[model samples]
Target: MKAFIVYCHPSENSFTRHIRDAFIQGVTDAGHECVISDLYRMDFQADMTEAEYLRDAHYRTTPDVAADVRAEQEKINASDAIVFIYPVFWSEAPAKLVGWFDRVWSYGFAYGDRTMKTLNKGLILCSAGNPIDYLEETGILDSMKKVMLGDRLTGRVKQAEFVVFDSTSRENPLREENWDKNLKAVYEKGKSLFAAK
Candidate 1:
């Protein structure tokens, strides 16, 4: 299987980076090919220009889409699965990723007369500062899943999942305590990414 990983993070000195690496390691170990888009490293333009917005707003596919967005769409069509790795901010994905959806999921590509392929899987792995119980209790986890899986990835992938490693705040002792365990789980997720299908 080929997995296109969209990783968003501002720094390498983060557990999120380690999770991404571990997931990649497991993917390779499973004998699968993977492509990555390090949004921050690539300095991906998340915000759409006025022209781009107008094109989408008007549902015009006449003017060619931006080369960068086209490239991202191409990647989606080429891959069998898509994985998003990032941190949860304000109960949502980082603004850059939010922008990624705004731009990459262009009107014609991700919707109307879409050329985008329906992939085998779509997975989201995000870290949160709050504990899992708290997130669940507050319905934040469900909301996140609904937004990512029910909305963004809906109809785009055959299967989808949202996993969050919580209690990862720098101030939380569980952050250090669960580091290895969390990474192991991430690796296992990668190794088993294609197992169900």
Candidate 2:
């Protein structure tokens, strides 16, 4: 299987980057192909232009999709699965990633008269500053899942999963304690992503 990873992180000096690397290594080790879009490195334009907003809002199917969005759509079509790696901010994915969905999931592509492929899997691996229990207790985790899996990824993939590596705040002592364990889990997830299918 080929996995297209959409990695969104502002800096390389972060745990999210390490998680991304480990996941890729496991994927390659498992004899699967992996393609990556390092959004920050690529300086991808996430904000939608007025024309793009108009096109989507008006439900126009014309080939007016921007080059960048078209390129992202092409990547999805060319892959067997899609993976997203990022850090959760304010109980949500970073603004950049949110904007990515806004533009890339165009009306004629991800919805309406769709041209996008329904992939085998869609996986979201995000890091959070709070503990899992806290996130769960506050219903933040469920909300995140609902948005990512229940909404954005709905009907777009055969199966989808939302996994968060929590208690990752720099000030948290558990951050160092769980670092290796978290990476191991993500790596294993990448390795076994396509095992069932």
Candidate 3:
């Protein structure tokens, strides 16, 4: 199966990057083709502008910018699964990643009428300040569920997995080994799900 991996982390040596890399490697080792969109590395713009919307509405898709948007949309359209790997800043996604959602997942591209209904899967791999239970108590996970699975992915993605790291560690918890464990768990789950009926 084809998996589109969207990673949003600024530092090259960040713990977030380490987790993302581990997930990518695991998915690749599982014999799946991976399309990676590294948001920070790409210098994506998080803010949405009315001007860009107008241009898109007019189909004034320039060769460079237009194709870039189309390229990401096409990848989403073709993928069987999507993996979102990023650090949870203030209990939400990084700014540029949010911008990615605003720009890349445009109307008639990421979603539309009943004409385009395809069941796919989405996996959210994120790191936060606390454990899943704590986050749930604070209603963080629910908000993300609505935003990630509800607003953005919608009916296009049926199955959704949330892999969260309890990062209240005194030091960096996203060490290579720890990140590998998380990725391995997610990868195994994916394999099992894929193998099922």
Candidate 4:
């Protein structure tokens, strides 16, 4: 299967990077083609401008936005699966990833009247500093459900899996083995979903 991985970490050596790499490797090892969108390396702009909003309003697509939107759409359209890798900042995705949603997943592209009938197939790989239980107990998961699932991401993807890791452990828990296990679980989940049809 073809897969797109949107990575949104700012630091190269961060735990987020490790988790992202592990997930990528898992998908690749499963014999899937991987397309990565490294937002930080690309220096993607997050804030939507009045001009941009106007373009969206008028459907005057920029050549650059048009090309990128096409590329992203192509990946989504061609792929049998999709993945998002990022670190949670303030309980949400980074500015660049959010910007990606604004720019790439524009109206008529990711959603429109036709979208209520069809959705893409994909998964999400998110690594956070806090523990999974903490995030769940504190309503972070609920917020994500509302934003990524209940809101924009809803009806866009037929299926999605959320992977959260505890990075703030006093003892470094992001060891090689732990990473392997984490990524394996994600891969297994994807495999099950992809093979269901």
Candidate 5:
């Protein structure tokens, strides 16, 4: 089985990057092929142009998608599973990821007689500034799940998951304390990416 990871982060010196590295290592160790799209490193064009907006808004399927968008879609079709790794920003994924959806999930491919394949799983690994309990209490957790799993990844993936590594703010001591533990768990998660469901 193959896994495709979409990693988004502006800085290399980040816990999120650590999560990504550990997860990738685990996947490779499990003997499954892995492909990574580091959005920031690639300087991916996240914003939708006027032509793209017009094509999507009107639900037109004839126009050809941009090369970059086609490349992402190709990756999705090639993999058995998909993973998204990033940090939570304003109770949501970074804007780059959001825009990825806007452009990549085009009408012809993601909807309206799409060619994208149905994957075995979809997983989200995100770091948060606040604690998980606080996020749950504030309803941020559920909202994030609904948007990511219920909406964005819905129908596209056979299974979907949203994971949050909370209390990762620089000021929080738990960031350091839980760092190893969280990475261990996510690495295991990666190892099982192709395990029987």
Candidate 6:
């Protein structure tokens, strides 16, 4: 199986970066292919031009999508699974990633007589500064999942999963303590990505 990993992070020296690497390694070790779109490293343009806005906001369904957005759509069509790796910011993905959805998920492609292929899986791996309990207690976790799985990924993939590695704030002792465990868990996720349940 082929996996398209959309990794969005500004810094290389981050736990999220390590998660991306480890997940790729596990996938490759299991003999699955991997392709990555490192948003920050690639300097992907997240902002939509006026033309784009006019097309999408009006549900124009035009084929005149930007080259970058078209390229991202092609990647989605070519892969069996889509993996999103990032750190949770303000209870959501980074602005760039959010913009990716805004632009790449175009009218003619992701919806409205869509040409986008339904993938085998869509998985999200995000790190959080606060504890998981805190996020859950505040209903932030459910909200995030509803947006990602219920909205963005629904009907786009055959199956989906959302995971959070919480208590990752630099000052939180759990960051160091759970580092290895989290990485291993994500690695396992990669290894088992296409395995029969």
Number of the top lDDT candidate: 6
Supply the global lDDT for candidate 2: 0.94
lDDT of each: 0.95, 0.94, 0.71, 0.69, 0.93, 0.95
User: Model 3 TM-score?
Assistant: 0.80
TM-score for each candidate, following the candidate numbering: 0.98, 0.98, 0.80, 0.81, 0.98, 0.98
How many angstroms is residue 28 displaced in model 6 relative to the true structure, after the best TM-score fit? 0.6
Per-residue CA lDDT of model 1 for 144-166, tens digit only, reads 99999999999999999999999
Candidate 4 per-residue lDDT, tens place, 1-197, comes to 67777888888977667766666666666666777878889776767767667767776544335556567767667666667778788899887888888877765666553322233565776777677777889998789757876776676677766666655343655544467666667666544544545
Poorest 10 consecutive residues of model 6 by lDDT? 61-70
Worst lDDT 10-window in candidate 2: 61-70
Worst 10 residues of 4 by lDDT: 111-120
Q: Across residues 1-197, which tens digit of lDDT does each residue of candidate 3 receive?
A: 88888989887766666667666666677677778898878776766577767755665543224556667777777788888988888778888888888777665555442223363788888877666787899898889777887777676678877767765343645444466666666556545534444
Tell me the tens digit of each residue's lDDT in model 2 across 42-148: 88898999888888889997757888888999999999999999999899888888999999999989999899999999999999999999999999999999999
Q: How far is candidate 3 from the true structure (C-alpha RMSD, Å)?
A: 3.7
Over 4 Å off, model 5: none
Task: Report the CA-based lDDT of candidate 3 relative to the real structure.
Answer: 0.71
Angstrom error at residue 129, model 4: 1.1
Better of 1 and 3 by lDDT: 1
In order of listing, the candidates' clash counts read 0, 0, 0, 0, 0, 0
The 10-residue segment with the lowest total lDDT in model 3: 110-119
Residue 143 of model 6 has an lDDT of: 99
